[model samples]
Target: MTPQWLTSIQTPLASAFYKRCGSKEKAKADERVAVIRDNSQQIVASLRLRRIGGHWLLRALLVDPQRRQQGIALQLLQFVGAQNPEPIWCFPYPHLQSLYHQADYQLVAEAPEPILTAYNVYLNRQPLLLMCCNR
Candidate 1:
């Protein structure tokens, strides 16, 4: 479903969206549509399907801090995976590697330039696992 603010490029949604993903930096929100789940008047979870260069990237997946361990993220990942059978790429934290593996994403030694470049700039110099789902 589309959020009304998402249609406007300069809306507060961009900042709010990245904040939801725990990011302080801005993103190109106009590049793709996001899937979100709301509870009452609050947004609980969200995931975006982004096109970077020629590839589809699963980006900015986040679940509210209060909603962790409830399988929401898994469901969202599955939904995104089912929607596109083509390969999708992501750079997930090392701890989430196994979870993405269960969703059919396998770690890759090499990634596309955009992904690789982004990985290098990821916060805290945190090690990220580059994975791809080749469904």
Candidate 2:
């Protein structure tokens, strides 16, 4: 089921995600979607799924500050994983490795060229985990 706010979330999603990631530059040029709370008419979370080098690169998952720790991000990850059973890759911050692992994403040592290039540019100096969901 597609969220009703999917079409209108690009700007707000980028804003919220950039705020959390501490880099407005990281939110550029990706296809994104949001999870909206039907009862409250608010977007609870957002994520980007970009096709890079024939693989789905799941990136920039962000939950509303007040909505963190409520399993919203995991739900979004699971939903996307279910929808795209093909290999899905992501570079998650070290702190989020366990969360992604709980969603069935495993650490990957290698990735496609586009993904590897992006990782080298964005996270090579950091302790981010490169993960993938192939189930």
Candidate 3:
């Protein structure tokens, strides 16, 4: 789902992300999709999606670090989950498992293959668990 707010902010975010990643190669990649929550004031949280397995995949989910445990993350997940209409898969930080599980997602034993990326390397190349939610 192409979010209107994300569509508005995408160019700048892509520019910043390309600079941080140091690569135009991945910046222009069509697979990346950004979803945001805003109330005509500020963005609450944002989730990124990438296509895999002929279905939409949840690639990144970030809540404002300052706004933890206020249901912001789950709200973002729920909103994005509703828009996509396909099973959503996630690779959440291990500590966030219980929280996501409570949101009707099931933890899985292995990471999905198509999502292996440099971000995983930064996360120590550990087996990032998978979780899926169908709504």
Candidate 4:
């Protein structure tokens, strides 16, 4: 069964979710956040979309540790595609290629600048996959 669709989340809550992922980065003012919340209204998973180089790049996909392996990440990626008409860029880890692939994201040889530069930096340190979902 498909998971419940995401709704726009406020900035503070978005930052909280990122913190839950052990990242110090907070949601930017220009970035839009989408989230899946539990019955108690606590965010279970979320991702940020920022317009970079005239494209929406997906970032900071975080799922509650207790909620992993439930396809929440795939559902969130699908939800982003359904909500946007433009192509969305994502730099998922190599291991998550299948998950992003199932969400309609295809492997891309190159991504836009700045983000690509960032991707290269991360790739230098660890394996990463650059994919984009065209809607």
Candidate 5:
């Protein structure tokens, strides 16, 4: 996909993705990874990135809601995964762990982390689950 530029540049794209995923407030956020636009200068999708263990980590990978399942996310992941030969660990949301597992990431151990208020509210109680993929 082609990279995009924006005039409404706001917060960091990674933060916007997490907040969007966490709060489901996509309309209110403008931060993005790579902004793809057509002619009118609108944000189509984001390829947000973050860091882990002192290494650059991919945090959010989103295809404009209308253009999903077309392998955009997979392409983005492949691009990021190839950035370095070092192992990449994705601490995914519970529902998404299976996707990673399908990508050959084995469940290594359960992560025990402090319960954030938002998740704690949804989980009835918070349980930290962890998984890792070997390079």
Candidate 6:
């Protein structure tokens, strides 16, 4: 039931976890990873909070396929939100708006510089929702 939020996600478990989510990038110093694992040490949920231009970007929120429908993602969201009062930006799918809303995140019309650039790129590819949790 214990989870970890660390600056490095280079561990074998983390690598495999991200791979399962279809993203396999090298861990950067500016990124922090949060992981919650099952009793067997298998990752059940995970997300990364990356500091971009002084803003925290939330991404890669992956919950195990078998573990969906549970509150694992919400739990992780709450954990991160509590860890710091800074605003966290996330670009999730439209369907996930309610999920992020439950974590006290509100829809935002615009984003800051670097993130706005990336957001536009994502918007072009798919329908997404941009939200921010300002604490």
Residue-level lDDT tens digits of model 5 in 1-135: 545433344534434554644534332243324444436644445554433334433344566666666655554555555544765554456776655665555664432232222224434543554445435
Best by lDDT: 6
TM-score of every prediction relative to native: 0.71, 0.75, 0.63, 0.82, 0.49, 0.85
lDDT of 3 by residue, 1-135 (tens): 123234533635644543443434232246454534445534445556667656566655665565567887776666666667767666667788877787667865454465444235535765665455443
Clashes of 3: 0
Which candidate leads in TM-score? 6
Model 3 poorest ten-residue lDDT run? 19-28
Question: Model 5, stretches more than 4 Å misplaced?
Answer: 2-44, 102-104, 110-129
Candidate order by lDDT, decreasing, is 6, 4, 2, 1, 3, 5
lDDT of 6 by residue, 27-61 (tens): 45457888888899778888888887888888888
Candidate 5, residue 67: CA error in Å?
A: 1.5
Q: Write down the lDDT that model 5 would get.
A: 0.48
Error of 6 at 115 (Å): 2.1
Residues forming the 10-long window of minimal summed lDDT in candidate 5: 110-119
Cα lDDT listed for each candidate = 0.64, 0.68, 0.56, 0.77, 0.48, 0.78
Give lDDT tens digits, candidate 4, residues 50-135.
Answer: 88768788888888888899888888888878988888877888788888889888877776686687667767876655555554
| Candidate 3: pairs in clash | none
The Cα error of candidate 6 at residue 24, in Å, is 4.8
Which pairs clash in the backbone of model 2?
none
For candidate 3, give the lDDT: 0.56
* lDDT of candidate 1 over 30-113, digit per residue (tens): 545444546454556665666767778777677778777877777667777776777788878778877787777887777778
For each of the candidates, the C-alpha root-mean-square deviation to the true structure, in angstroms, is 3.9, 3.5, 5.4, 3.0, 6.4, 2.2
